[model samples]
Target: MTNTALDQALQTLERATSTPELVKATQALCALNDLEAAKPLVKVLGFNNPAVAAVATQGLIQLGRDTIPILLVSLDARNYGARAWVVKVIAALRDPRGLDLLEHALEADIAPSVRRSATRGLADLELSEDAAHDQLVRCFEGLLKAVRDDEWVVRYAAAYGLEQRLNSAAVSAHLAEQGRAALNQLASDAEGVRVVQLRALKALQRLNAG
Candidate 1:
């Protein structure tokens, strides 16, 4: 799509009411493959309507890593809703700094979802060394509780933490039963845990190379 066409689609996104129209607009923009489109798309971060925010978040994701810095900047938004979405965006980014920001948010942010995401992002990043073992243990304990959270995202993220930390055989075995259960649940159920769990499983699987 041309720049003019993409701009026209974005305008339609602004006025769109139905899901299909917004999807079409996003598809056009995504096909353009310009991450810069996500810069303006960040406005959707603050969109008053939840549905609009959801759509905008989807668009921002289609922009991929391009959205990470913008999402990180948005984490400081005064609005809790925006911050929560930014946490999700950062988790989606799952880049190196992604977990670092999450650690910062875990220590400093007030919102539960944001804190929750930070913990999960820490798991996703899988830090090395015993430097933060104290914090990791504490975070994993919290995730233990999260593994059963009514919120599926929270529950699986907790499990994902288990998946990432299996290198610490001591730590991995501590929750071995729960880890198996989570992966079992994921395989038995649908949509709750996916690649994060898979990645964690691979991490654990590799530690036995001895």
Candidate 2:
């Protein structure tokens, strides 16, 4: 589509009162892949509509690295829901630029859901570790800590991460030690909510079977 055509479509998206109109505009913007669509797509992430949010996220990911700087800045957005969505986008991109931000959010974000998303980001990353293995160890340790987080959802996410990786042949001894200890503790968590403990127990079961 031409730049003028893209701009008009985005304007229609902004003014869209009905779902069909919004979806059409969203589809147009996704097809356009113009840099100008980044801000509007980011705004769509904050919308209460899940369909719009999914479309915007896919569009932004298709736009690729151009969306990273905008997303990084948006991490500071006042709306926690938007921040949560932005983190998921960054996680999907798997850009190293997002690693520090993801780690910080995991450690400190006030929102459990944001922290939950951050765990997935950290889990799926392949960081360039130094000789001391700080980066790799940090990622593992962060998941370990998150497995015991106050929120059951956060714990569930952490357990999910460990569960998926329990049998990987490539796991280093150090990382395995960290993951196993954390999983074992989570598996037997006396005070955790039933679902959280169940996830932990399942992860441990998977580990044993692996």
| Every model's TM-score | 0.58, 0.86
Q: Where is the poorest 10-residue window by lDDT in model 1? A: 183-192
Candidate 1 regions off by >4 Å?
17-27, 48-51, 126-160, 167-210
lDDT of 1 at 106: 62
Best by lDDT: 2
lDDT of candidate model 2 versus the reference: 0.79
Query: What is the per-residue lDDT of model 1 for residues 19-124, given as tens digits with 9 covering 90 to 100?
Result: 6775556556656767767755566555555665676677666677766776666654577777777777776666655655776766667676776776677666
For residues 134-209, write the lDDT of model 2, one tens digit per residue. 6556667778878768898888888888865556566688788878887777777463588877887888877787
lDDT of each: 0.62, 0.79
The clash numbers for all candidates, in the given order, read: 0, 0
Candidate 2 similarity to native, TM-score: 0.86
